[model samples]
Target: MNKSTYITAENPMSATFRYLAISIMFMFVGFLFGKLFVPASLVYAANIFVVILIVGLLIFSLMSRKNVIPTSFSMNFVYLFTFVDGILMYPILTYYLYDLGTSLFINIVLSTCVIFAVFAFISHKKPAGYFIGLGNILLTSLMVLLAMTIVNIFFNAPVFNILVSAFGIILFSAYILYDVSTLKHYIESGRITCKNDLSIHVLNLYLDFVNILLDLLRIVSDLKD
Candidate 1:
């Protein structure tokens, strides 16, 4: 339950499980939110909500950089908001899950693969933290996601869509492991001390849940069809 317990390297197994549990819980909340608001207007509401959340995250990150804000509160907010972002992203992904086909799915998979590859490369060199290459990775990932989304407008392939959902499950699950491991490593090594470190831990849990939920959703969708 404590944030510190979630990132201690000395207890990776426990931490990993805890991290996964956190992800699962948040994912369920996201799913519930999606289910409760199942309507055309949900998409618009989600879009506006995500936009505001992103703006707030940006503003906080900016202020924190200047050391103008309290680290504890700022970091806690970061963790909380990032969790919300991760939860909200599910609806957006859900909206597109069945709408995209093979080509677009392939594009999304390839894009994600490239992002992981880049993250792997950067981490090998730095092996310190995601923040080191966060800006570049985030930008490139967004570009690829946008490109894939745009291409979907031209071609909608059901087979590919299913595959994308499957891959998303795998990719995001692996990310969960990696994120949890690194977080634990950081804590054990005395790299992370402040509560702000919780932001990154929470973010990792959020991504894990998102992908796991996507995988589950895809399975359900397939069974239904």
Candidate 2:
């Protein structure tokens, strides 16, 4: 194979895997820092700043130089996002970690990995566009769920809470499928340039993984209670 072809085709899946690993590692790093070093108040304040900064950085990166970002700068953004995210999640993770124990956290991690692997395999085998329709449906469901969540804050509906968690589990699982499917399509179609915009997919998968784990944790904790 020519150098360019090899560069493009040689283990496209590697990008996906690398991004996933980095994401998980950063998440853990953030989790530890948040849990041990940062207070809730500081994390809350930093949360707002980090989120805006990360989003702005991502947008700028995508818009510049054929959608390619400098590795150094991109890495910095990734680290910052994870560190801040960890800090933000510390309070919630602390609650569940204490109530549910570390074992449950491990279980959720393993479970999410397996589930994502299965979907990745499917995405590799299946053609793209298959999940687009389902993704749209899930997106709509997510929107309504968000609305309901806002309402629940004031209404404090127990049933609605369980329903949201259940639906969140399903929605995020489908998101994994959609994202993997989308990733495969973009890689093949030359839209995503796995080398350049891999961060985009990484962020997408990380969000899916975290959301699924959180929802699963919620359901399991409720059942245990």
Candidate 3:
């Protein structure tokens, strides 16, 4: 299929959102499959698989960004990756669902949606360049956060974990604003001229939403403890 078959300059935003919706749907399907069919005994193995998949996807995304990979292929990869990711989320989701109960789980999801929507709206109103400039600062913060996470693994301190989770919430919240603005800039500047480019934006938004949900979940769990 032609690269531009689904996307057009006039309505790139709509096309991107459509792709995002589809990706999220695939993730939900994967989550259900994992929750229902997968044995709890395999959760550890699933975590290993997910870690490897994440690394692979990161490499693939880098290649796609450099235009070394075909856009069509990259788009398909995004969907598959998202599905696997959702399946892997089974363990964490169940923990939260069971521990917090159905109502609280729903509330957490609603809160995530609200946070995502607010940042997206803010991005829409701001000039893309403003958020684009934040790219470096966010990346630096992310690296520092990763280092802290690694250190916490050894110490396993509750206070440290809480601090990291709090930092993560702030970092990823900024990321949502940056990513949404970047997507808007890409569409407006004609950088996203094909359907394939939409995959990256879909993945970015998905990660942003998921990360924020996770950080919120951790915080809530800590509070409960």
Best by the TM-score measure: 3
Candidate 1 wrongly placed segments (more than 4 Å): 1-75, 78-150
Residue-level lDDT for 190 in candidate 3: 67
TM-score winner between candidates 1 and 2: 2
On residues 54-158, what C-alpha lDDT tens digit does candidate 2 reach at each position? Answer: 234324322331235342235446656766776667766766676778998778768878877887677667887667667657666666655655565566555
lDDT of 1 by residue, 34-78 (tens): 556656566545533433433343343334333465433444354
Q: lDDT of each model, Cα atoms only?
A: 0.48, 0.64, 0.72
Alpha carbon deviation, residue 4, candidate 1 (Å):
13
Q: Which candidate order results from sorting by TM-score in descending order?
A: 3, 2, 1
Model 3 lDDT vs. the true structure?
0.72
- For each candidate in turn, give its C-alpha RMSD to the true structure in angstroms: 9.1, 6.0, 3.7
- What is the TM-score of candidate 1? 0.47
Better of 1 and 3 by lDDT: 3
Badly placed stretches (over 4 Å) of model 3 are 1-10, 42-73
Off by over 4 Å in 2: 1-6, 40-76
